[model samples]
Target: MKDIKDINKATVKNKTVPTTTGGGVKKVIYTLSTIQRIGLRNSAKALTSHNACKACGLGMGGQRGGMTNELDEFPSVCNKSIQAQSTDIQPAIPNALFNKHPLLDFQELSGQEIEHLGRLGTPIYKAKDSQHYCEVSWQEALDRIAKAMRKTPAQRSFFYSSGRSSNEAGFVLQLLARMYGTNNINNCSYYCHQATGVALTNTIGSGTATVSLEDLNGCDVLFLIGANPASNHPRFIHKLKALRERGGKVIVINPAKEPGLVRFAVPKSAKSLLFGGTEIASLYIQPSIGSDIALFKGIAKAIIEMEAITEDFIHEHTKGYDNFLTNINATEWQEIVECSGISREQIGDIAKIYAESSNTIFAWGMGITHHTHGVENVEYISNLALLRGMVGRPGAGLLPLRGHSNVQGIGTIGVKPVLPQDVFDGIEKNFNITLPSEKGMDTLACLEAAYDNSIDFALLMGGNLYAASPDQQWTKKAMDNINFKVFLTTTLNQGHVNGMDNSEALVLPVTARDEEWQATTQESMFNYVRLSDGGIKRLDHVRPESVILTHIAEQVLPDSQLDFSAFRTHNNIREAIASTIPGMEKLAEIGTSKEEFHISGRLVHDYNFNTQDGQASFITHSILRDEREKPLPYTLTTVRSEGQFNTIVYEQKDSYRDTDDRWSILMNPATIEKLGITENSCINVRSAHGVMNDVKVFPFDLPNSNIMAYFPEANILVGRDHDPRSLTPAFKSVNVDIEVVERQPSLSTS
Candidate 1:
């Protein structure tokens, strides 16, 4: 085993490849033929898995395939493959990590190793040089976690959960955290679509998608905004295909160029699989990052001028149309075109398609949510739907295609820093306790607390918070200041590897979504409540998060008012959740079944709302733009490679740009030239707290002026003070000047 010092010195090769010409891209797009589509489908239909290396021609097995080192190499190779697939090119190293995991100390990685690590992460702390990590028992780990959270000023403690938890475990975790006195529940939704949920609920009186499966063929237009369902949520592609079959027009807008928006292969559909995938988006528009607000604002302006607004619907169900129209009228067309980077004719064409349609469905992803002005963009998207009465219709509504399967469901169950007014009262009344009054901590808040020494402890339910947050050093230092930290994960990551300052900080490994959770789980789309039948037992060493929380609660709050032990059975937690949240009332009775109960909203289609006066309230949004524009040469928006999810480096390959996970900040060629940076220049991305040096440069046609830095890496540049609205840590947009720097010495070969 290598010593921590020696391992820290392990060098990685983070290299760059040559760029291709624009003409080659044009030839592929200009010559789309009927027979080519047929052949493509046939090739897709014949796709299957293999056991050998798909890229480097490496074999999988025996001496080299030894489990010990092989486990560490897997995520690196996965990241490499995913990068290649998304970018349409290959990496210099052929494959990242050769099959190693993504956990690493970035600062010391060699050029070769950095290629596989994907993002820049350096493990600041390790238990020992030889052991690398000391596996603590489940009990010892959770006990330490519970103690830390209890010592914190309850208000400073943060609880970050993931979508992989079973409902039984999710409810218990949330209930226990809240009972301990803080609503600082930060889930993946804060980054994905808290804006969509909050905005949709305010405008339509419902936060969920109003359209059901039956409504797929009921729409005239399927607008794909800020979402890529083909690779992210492939299960929902049938709906889009069905709409096209019914003569519907589709529209898409995103910063990165994805093959999915242009095409998709349905692994499940026989016809779709046999016939090559159907064209999902009829028109594709690659808009600049953080420009969604202006783009949608342009659409709304056109709708109003063309008299596309449904006057009858507005007069009967809305409150702020006149004020909204006034703001729309105030906008200049040229400003919208310049800001959104969309031609007037294109905007007019989208407006015409929308006007011609009787029903339209709008769905978005993180592209619309990561900006400082994310909330405003979501509201603007909702405003477009409301102008034509699309909110509650069968085929027209807002669906923020969330990442992580049940990210929405977990929020539905019990993951919130600040519970809604009703749930807050219900929990207090039900538990016979008055919860703490201070505004609970959120993601950025927790980071600030860690840095300021306000929080003595932090609890991570099921996320890589340290790696996912902006300004990696800010969060890293914040954790160091804290008395203790807890990470609940399936594999080692930058958090456990680097964030821990005290040996008191512990890491607890658990099961993933594909395995039996020993409890019930939920998905936003199917099987609202899925009961785990104990399909295949995981190694005894691993346990569900719910079980961990229960034991910890028992040990820490031994005599608390609530019977924390009841959580041993996931069903008990579900029943408890059902009692307070009306949506889950039948969860205990329904158990697990093939049938997934659609979240019921009686007023959704009826147009009756729960707001004051039973009508939807609208906020007349004045278009707000990103004020910080220091990285003026280009605008960058980080879009995930098709093979990865969130911060999990399942693959090192990015197919779209034909690259690997080397923590490279991709920019537009024009922006790079304007800034006097070479194509493969090494630049230091300087921000408020510090600088991340030795990051490679790859120029592409993403958002001009904005540089789209990949997650876990770019997040390192975001400051703790950035995420003001939802405390999401402005991961989407950051104001920073790029300075070209000389490359650091190689750690591997040296």
Candidate 2:
């Protein structure tokens, strides 16, 4: 095994002059290394068995429950699946270790070290005055939690969830929150895809993907905007490969110019892996960060000038075409170029490609959502698609590629502040309980409420809320204000240590999804639902989240209208889900039939929409301007490294970007030279939120006035700036001032 010193030295060699696009030899090597790190023998089942990849929302796996993809081919897993499953299946950390390392000791360790501490073995507790956490019995833990929760009113308590959970678990947990007479239930989506849901629903009558997985295969053109599927969603590369092989065109639009999207070596095909990778983008467009709306509107204007509009389709299936055209014509060419950072001719060329393609799919990621005008970005993209008749067709529509494995499913199960009236009616009639009618708070609202001491209790199903949130200092302070914060998760994260202001904290260990005693369900970005037969428990004391939530509900709400005991059975939860949730009627039968299904009423293959008028709407929106009091030299956008998933750092190195140091920021080489900042120079990065000193600077291909930094770490510089409509934090367009600082001397004594 290589020593840590050797690994650190190797980082210099590993650093690429320009980052490799996505999957290739490095991904394969990293995958094997992680598998070896966790012991290949121990992870054999997780890799070879039938299960869903917990990495992204692409929904890859054996269609019928084995480790294969929906195509039912064996060994269809990717590097991400291996890394995530291996890390999860590692041996539990013994209770003695917690005693050996006090709370302060654990707090002093780095994120990488803390991640290497292994799985949480047992339930633990920290009292109001205790300096260290002590192991506790399940009964005692539940009793204490029930007592703390009982003291707080339902309106003052909130429930937060991550996309990692199963549909059964999310539904039951949210139901518990609503049954407690409070609608203050929300999921982590408020931080990521909330804009996508809100915008798509306004335009197409549905918030999710209109096209199915099969639609992607048949599409002739794909506008893969904002998202970087190579590092973030590796399995998605396979789809791009298939699309290219079928003579399709993929136009990638992202500011960073990711290597994988430019060209990729997919391991699925040995030929492609052994030689050079398959080409991904036929055309790549890089607009200034948060300028997607301007770029898209420019394309719309060009399409109109070229007379490529699908007039018949627009007239028959759309509304507000005249007003949309008027707005496009009224907009000046110079304003578009200035805001979009692309030439009018270039925009016309892109429009020409779309004009000719018979079928095209419009897709995007957080780059489009994490902005003040995020809703407008989505609207502009929809406008372009509507002009070209791209939506509700056989091989084309809108797809907001989600990040979490089951986040969309969580929303479908009603994990939001407000529930649809019909769904609420179903729940009330079936469960014999009157849910709270008052307005509920979202993730940001919850934090603000906590800061004001209006919220007394907080329950988290999964996700590192503290680290994942923007403005690290504010988030920590807000979290600390809650009287009691309960986190039910599989392992320890930074949130456990710093993300609380609560007088008391509780950490309840939960089993991984593949280890649950009962089967569960997860929804893919494509709306297909898969069943996971979970029977591989790694720890003895750890319990499934459903079991924990049920027990907690039983203890906290003994006199409630529903029977908490009935929820112990996963089947009962699914039955309730199928009967109450719209378009999910098949869930009730999943347990018995063992059939993988797709939720109805989502895939809009025809012109018939779910909207009131059964027609799509065209929305006009205004462009954003620089409103900063002191304009910074560069805008810093926080991104995820290739080494891990959301907030979970499996490896400190970002192999794709070729940076081993997580504290490093990527910038243009010319800009670095112009500023007289040499390579490896430490710098102080300041934003409205906070300041991060000693951040390493490196050369990379970014826009002239833009730079990139790793998320969670750089989340400190992110503030409460968000889209007014969706409340999703504007993480991609943060204005920051950077100044070179003296480089720190190495502390190593070799």
Candidate 3:
């Protein structure tokens, strides 16, 4: 591991350069440069293609045009959209890529380096004895996968999907797996927002966001917690800007003092870009990692003491309020302050903000869900919303800022280890086949089963399972235990190389959403579905995901009762989805109508919930004092840089943090002084699972004893410990000990 010394040394001395504002002149220049590199015509064509934006789940693009959002606002594009578009329209990967490079050589490449190799245009296979992958015919690759799956017990095979696929592809794949006598079907949500789904389901009887895009317009206060939308969801900044302009307050609660969250310039707005920028957070609160529950309880207690609870709404629309109130009243302020690392006055001030607002929306991201108490974190957020009758009303609800474009859609289409009774009945009745009755394993469980050599086959659609998972070494070992593995993707990632060590793996090239010949659909985070009119294929050999999946199904289960051939076209698959999946009946005619619609019964405009009693429930949890256990020197949290999306590193430099390296640890200046370490000092970070060496330490504006590192690369330090209810890995809060390896001389400021 090479050490990066003084990555931000130059930026630290440059007083003229501003790092706080996001999406100003810098974004405009970056967009132009991207378009120039990809060719103006090609970039424009891909951008204007009638498809949903393949970036964040903010619901941009569709029939209204590619640059439009769900609200029909024009010019809704962001850097994430441009990055995804540029990646898709790139030329095909050369055949020599596999022939010249051995598997070991590919493992040495970075995530961005691997992705820059271009799109996968041909099917490739690697036998167990082979050291390198060789191009193979599609028929042979599919046949090999079918043979392996056919020979293995259905229970021994697991299928996983990423958020990149369309609803049609997700629906077809999950249905095929169930009909093949297995229920081991899951998606990437298990790693990201499974906590949000589980907690929301238990509290409000819905697993998705209760408010729609339009509801954001009516919100008076936006409680942005645990999410840094400026980097992850850049398009959301416009909404925040508009809200602030309308006298609405935006409260940001996070561990790090993210510069983008404090202030941001809207790329589309001239005044914002020309001026200093728009103020995003009216009040920014910094809390310790894994301390969100205590902070939420403190806020609830403050609200109760201030006599701000909506007694009538609680009495009529919710249950267990008394118990919840008791839990809040019992929680001491000293405990909240000690655990959350936030002063009592600050907590009271934020509560006062919420109390004054009539319509408030509570939103969060992976920070809240990527913990051992991930589910409880979400439930407490819900509890806060319910305290003021914020849920099941216009402009007032809970929003889980889903990272992927179609992750929520994949879950809605039944890509899960288990299914609801209604979904099971619908699949059986619609397909005229008896579904499997065995309980299935989630993503982690499947990996564990594979580690034990119980799982023989695995199929991954669109995402890098190895890179997205916790404990990189363990994930690779688990995958090695499987006999056969198949990956359906457009480009190569760390998974394609590191995950296929001991298994006979096949990588099949699939068309990107913009490259699909048939029209597809994706559901946004707001429960709204958008139809993508897929354009011409970028490569001849690459096929639509739905087409490839159906072909495999036909080859594997030729005699099965389910008609695999019928799902060849996206329209046919949509029809099947309409018949089986709830709130998707509109999909049957979406192709002809070109009409996008929100899923029914998901949006909570009224007080009625999907629970048996038609009322929401207030759930309470006791804050664990064990979270303060100091076995390690610091509490490390994994984060994505401004230039990265999920596990894919687009650019190593995090411009927002004024750092030009990804393999560096960020700490507060106070912590650095306490530890007697200088900026850019090389160190070894040790975790319970693994150790990272030659990592440079940079001073950042974070709480003392709290540090931050880029994810996936730092994922090696994360263990398999996860939330008991949602099974989401604790990526946000890991105990780590740091040892200084080498100290670089301080930079000379002349």
Candidate 4:
């Protein structure tokens, strides 16, 4: 066997503007390099197939066409799409290789090295006290899992899923778990976008994006808060560029001043491709971490003072306007300025811009949702939109840019801890199965259950829970307490290697989206559903996810009321989903027609809303005041690098930030000087949860008294503190103190 280091790592060059926005020659070059690494033949095959982009929730491709979006635009792909495709198109990992290393040895590998361990192409089991995993037959794997399930109570067994799977797979998995008599079903969304779901549902009567792709494009002004689309959503930069060309304004609100968000060179445009970059953010506001509520409240107060309220819209279409206005009026300017870290005049200017725009859209990402007051933050965003009557219109609404591609789809298909009454009734009628009415545990609650030794078994459909969750040590310890764990994945990840400690752990290798032989469906962030036409199977040992899920269901429930065999195929699964999930009725024929359709009742284009009162309501929240007075006062925010996805590092270097080291924290030069520290200084960052010892610090452009660190690495320092309303962890607003580490002298021999 070849040593892992013997294989050449893909060389990536940072050849674009320093600390920049998006669109550039570097992206084009990087895309090509990624293709070459996966081989041209594989890249062409995978890229030409009708499959969704596994990277983000934008839904860049489908059976409607290859490299096309829901709008049917050709070549709608980005570097993220190429990177994910290349990762999926690689050859399978053989059993002989698994025999070469034990589970403990795999722990020493980095995220990139582990990903390069090749595709997990077969089912492998680690027996009690076994050092390495050995190959197991499909029947044996199913039987063992089923036998284990038969012994464990349904309430003690948890089923978790990631957002990358198809609607058919997630729906079936959740259905099987419920039929087994438990509602302990949840997906990756709970950790990332649950705040958006809770807050949006309370305000607009809808949890998903309230606008369509057309509305986003037609909006005259876009308020992008707590989102770094330039790095996470590369294709989104193109839309921003188009907005700029049409004289639309983009107001970016984030603590760190990302160069890519400010100005970007659009490679697709001849003018931008040949000359200087296009300016993205017309107005940029840098508020302190956890201060978005104060900033937005200040903006609302200013708008009200200017008498810019849309009275007719507010009177006829919304509730609680008077109370909301009263709260805004009561908020003092001094308190707002001190809390938001922005001047009162600047708040007025932002309000003026929002009031002047006839059409506007409000959009945000994890930054707004990964805080203790995440739900409140989202409510404030909606409050601003309602003040201007920006929602339920042609060119306005709220859009929570989801991270994973089909995360919205998974939630829509009943992969949640609690199902709505209508959805629950629909499922019982359609599948003839009476599910449990008891509320189920969410993702965070599941971890707590495991730690208490209440959970006997856990089946993770996808995602790296160990790395993605807050407080890495706590998560690992909780996972180790589970009796048996199973991971269905395409490649080697940290979860497979270290998430479990018991010998009954199993790894089931499944085909990737583009490699499956059956068609599947995925939902977009805009409530659009796209059918994916699967291509040739890449590995001989691997099977479709639907097949594996069905077989497991059959083994676990010997006499299930629902026809588990019917779900073996994709179309039948869609039929079940269409009948149960609202607005997904079109999904029944999507596999055969290859038609891309939008989910109904989600996109608000009229006065009617899904809320109980048929009118949007103002959800009020008090400005969260930081009462802590600490000597170590810097607030630490976890951020993703341009070359990385969620919990997955494609490249070690952050091309935009010009940093190859992942453990180092990014800080303002002024802040570093004030702290009596210099660039590249080794420091100990202590948070309430834990401490990151001897981490190197780099000077960069960031808000004063704020520091930025890479995620997963910094997740250790984040406590499991979360919003009470929405269990989303506060990964964004962690208070930390930095202490300089003294350097030790070299050894005498040296």
Candidate 5:
């Protein structure tokens, strides 16, 4: 509600960065806070440090953190040290290895474990506090995992999957877990997109995006709700920028007005540079955090009042149309306006544009999916899209913006405990076995169980559970309670270095997608499975995830019992994925190109209703804005910044709102004045989960009454019980009462 120029500490127009050797330029904003200055100084220190990049574990390539993006005159004081890190200790790719057969080692995968992993993977561990890791062979590691799985109770055992895995590998892992007896399989989606899946599918017939990335070109109106594509998914900028140039309208809705949502100059575009770049969004709607439900309900109401409803489409392809309309209009306009922090006129205008556009796309980021009603919000969008027949049309559809490439792929592979019956039946028929019918636990359920000691052996496929979960202190303790733990990862991250480890915890190094996996084909948000074979090979001493998982299953249970050897060979596993899932059958063949692979058995991208009755499913629910008064003085909103990826932490000194590491919390100016807090004042943020101390505060770009917090740091403030339907932790909604710390606490405990 204030001028950005006055609030933003830094300006982009005053600074200029290189676009490229030809003539591409990108404008980035930053504040000149002491925190930023110190961070920049420390970065120069680390770039010149003896340590690794700490994010991707890539040895400091001669470039300084230095894989790419290195320049002379820059890093002058720090370049030498960064170059030393990349070339010295252990080469990312040794010169001798480059000359060998594959040009890259098939087993040198220090992978992601090298930097973030610290010193954990040198010889590996049987548990914490081991004297020395006598280097174990691949066979030995596999045997150890297998032996542990067999001894552990199936019900007591639990699985954690990361989005980094491929379809073939994920499918094999899920199958192995189900075959083991317990259906308690959990993937990263439980933390990120589970709500979106539940919400969208119930509203429309399908869960994934209705249109492919290629379909964006023809979109006439794009609604970017609770999303910032520039920092999260840069590739999407190409599509959005193109849409803008075509005279299309883009509406961005969020608690904070992200600069990327308003404008972006793509360094990859040519015509844009000639014209000094086109504007990205036509209007930016700043709403209160966790008020997405209210916002959507208002939009639905407006569409109805505007008479934009496709009456024929609703009658022919959708059910419960009348009821849904009734629920949408059930709420009073004044209440919606007060709750959403957006005007009634703004809501109606966006809906008018949406109903008028020939093609429209609604894309949302974590902001929409990280709440208690994340699923409900997703379903709301789907039903809204269905009303206007936006889905299954060119440049128009529901796009669930996913974090970490191919998290959707894991869903397609059915890693959930509640495997879709049709999917389970299909896979069981192919394998000729009766799969378990029990629904399994999600991330929150698994964590709560672990706290109660329900989980026996826990295996994390690629995430840092201890750090990623809310109520960090509690989550960390629960992890330690597990009898056994195993992580299949590329890097040594924060979670790996300081998490709970019982007597049987192990870290297995695996090749990153950047490195070549013999039989792996990665699926993107579009469900496009691309084989990333640079003709490169996995490193020595390391294995592909599929290979590692299958080998472990075989060691624990032989082929006579499960025949996991078939899953060991990548091709066989690919075939298994093809047969088990309806859409994945196309990946049955070997390939080295980006191929359009089917994931859902139902027809999509053309709006063919695939419900049991061959109609789009519609849910009519009244939007209930909890005007509940917060007992606390402040409300905390978590957010992702432009510089970092989700939980990956690539090291950016400045945040999207404050641009300073010192002030971890960004408050509205009015909120700050109301609370009587000063800049850089230390305080505590509390929610149902727990409380946090020493968090810095800043007046940011958010609306009054909303406080913008960051992840991993603010994650602990969100509670597990906040999730509405899918049991996914609602990280977005947290009412925190902030007050100055009277006296500093002891050094160690948070």
Candidate 6:
């Protein structure tokens, strides 16, 4: 048998390319090359266009011009922004794409390959028995979708939205769903940051970042936990570097020692990029997977022992401090160390750094929220922040590093399974229609319901639902069980093909946010709304998402009290949003006034919170313990590559990790040695849900007994088990066993 190293030798080398720093000269070259690949003029136009960034939710671009951030800083672009623009500006997909390729053939393509197939320019539909999709007119597609929705029961239909869409589109979609008599409305957040929302709301009476860019600027220390902003949110690296330059401390806590977190070269800084990059993390801590609560408890214990707790803040601005303190004191240090995989000395050292900082910001990503106890993890993080009086104050608070640019906006505009009572009543009062009062299913519930043959129709507005879901086989089966499914997309993804089997599905081509005809608004993670001045359409056949949604609403609910046809105009929808969604009144003037504004009541700069008593509450929880008899010896955490965003694979190689293969797992050398496996050997990784066979293994700088792999590809090994509170699947921590498929000679021994 051929050696696995010979199959993908470049990936097996496991070398750090050009040192450990991220976004150096390589990023500049990549940006210029991307611009060359897509026409320079198109790239320039897209970059300079007045649109919110389509990448992470760090809030870049808008009225300040492209490549600018919320702080009005110029030339703030990153590789993520460039890649997204290049993909958007590509020429329309060949008119004969659907005709030339069968549905089954498309399923064989990887996420990156499908993305490179170019943008979807026309509406296409596949019949249940059809082997290929055929192009259909917009009218025919809308009519068919309306017909299906009209016949289907409201409870059996679910409306889902992706974060890539505009706030106007999200608002209109959710409104249509409610008007159609279903509260089964959800967005992609349920799979990503829903735990952050649930935890923050319960603790501080708000679900978003309490601090803004200004707060980040003034922070004395940043506690970055379970997040790699260097790869996912490159613009955020600038903040870290700036904070470091000002003598601020950065504490990073994760199982893997990410190279970018250690050091990163700011692309905009010539001296930093050409020279050695700026130091980022002052201290890096690695703990066991699924042990965040224990680590946090350790920190809390250390803080209490050192008398670092803010007694005045806890007593006056917060509640439940006494009980929380009791639990922290009662918790034994031995248990904390055993569960966290960190020494007591190290935990105390971390607490010391946080305790010394007068103002600290607690920021996290999916790594903190992708476990069975995801909500508890977030709550514990909040607990630490509250202990230091970090929350509800300037330059300090909880910041969930949201992935998509408009994901926060989507949730803010009522695209959820349940709406707040005020917003629910306001929608009814404004539209003169009574919405369904029944409880609705979330994203997971919707899929499970469909799998059980209880759901008949699904409308997904802009996201790869199949690739983003856990337990790939189960998600596929659930999608197939649905009678009809509609996907509004700008480009092809695995979901377009693999998500459906026996179901009839429609792929509707929609214009991107930058290509829309009407100006739209998007809210950033900081609760700041920005206006995007839409540009000329790249494809004539494609329509705006708002327009399509309004047309479907018109067809589905004709003669309804709400004037659906009027909503086809984006400004009308904005007016409706301003009237319904509290703190969104600024959206009404955003279209004409061109004034971007922040939504009120989200950022908590003062001690007062939105709770009934106007004080933040402390939530206490015992550290999570896994007592189950495990079938696997190692824990697996699914992570995104530097070349990828969410489930979309912009590139197959991860330059930061220096790996050229996506179908590979990163294991600690000690674990590989203990398992009697050599580097570059092919192995089968099995989890409770599924198995991935013949995967190449590479040694990485992860903690012992823990392994890392890229997401979506590794998503198959992730189980359907999710946090009971938030329902977010445990993507970051899973019990997996590796079986050797092929043995390769060790390079060192050879």
TM-score of every candidate = 0.79, 0.95, 0.97, 0.96, 0.82, 0.97
Report the error of model 2 at residue 324, Å: 0.7
Which pairs clash in model 6? none
Q: Model 2 residue 326 lDDT?
A: 88
Q: Which pairs of residues collide in model 4? A: 20-259, 20-260, 21-259, 21-260
Task: Tell me the spans in candidate 1 whose CA falls farther than 4 Å from its real position.
Answer: 1-132, 142-156, 265-278, 513-517, 525-527, 592-595, 625-632, 672-694, 721-723, 740-750
> Model 6: which ten-residue window has the lowest total lDDT?
1-10
Candidate 3 residue-wise lDDT, 1-750, digit = tens: 121001122243312123467778887888899899999998888889898899988878988888998788989989999988777887888888788777888888889888888888899999998879999999999899889988999999999999989999999899889878888999999899999999999999999999999999999999999999999999888899999999999999999888888889888999998896889999999998888988998999999999999999999989999899888888788988999999999999999999999999999999999999999999999999999999988998999999899999999999998898898899888878898899999899999999899999988998989998899899899988898989999898888988676779999999888888888999999999999998856788998888899899998899988788888877888888899888889999999999899898899999999999988889988887546676887999999999988887789888888777899999876666656667777899999999999998777777888999999889999999999889889999999998878854444447
Q: Compute the lDDT for candidate 2.
A: 0.83
Using lDDT as the measure, the top candidate is 3
After best superposition, candidate 4 residue 140: deviation in angstroms? 1.7
**lDDT tens digits, residue span 130-213, model 6:** 878988888899889989999999989999999989999998899899888888999999999999999998899998999998
Compare candidates 2 and 3 on TM-score and give the better one: 3
Tens digit per residue, CA lDDT, model 2, 57-172: 88876335445666665556677787678668767777877666556677666666676677888889888777667899999989998998889899999998999998888988
Predictions in order: lDDT: 0.59, 0.83, 0.88, 0.84, 0.64, 0.87
Q: Candidate 4, residues 291-361: lDDT per residue as tens digits?
A: 98999999999989999989898999999888898888887899899888899889988988898998888
Give the worst 10-residue stretch by lDDT in candidate 5.
14-23
Error of 5 at 396 (Å): 1.3
lDDT (tens digit, per residue) of candidate 5 on 171-203: 878878888887888788888878877876676
Model 4: lDDT equals 0.84
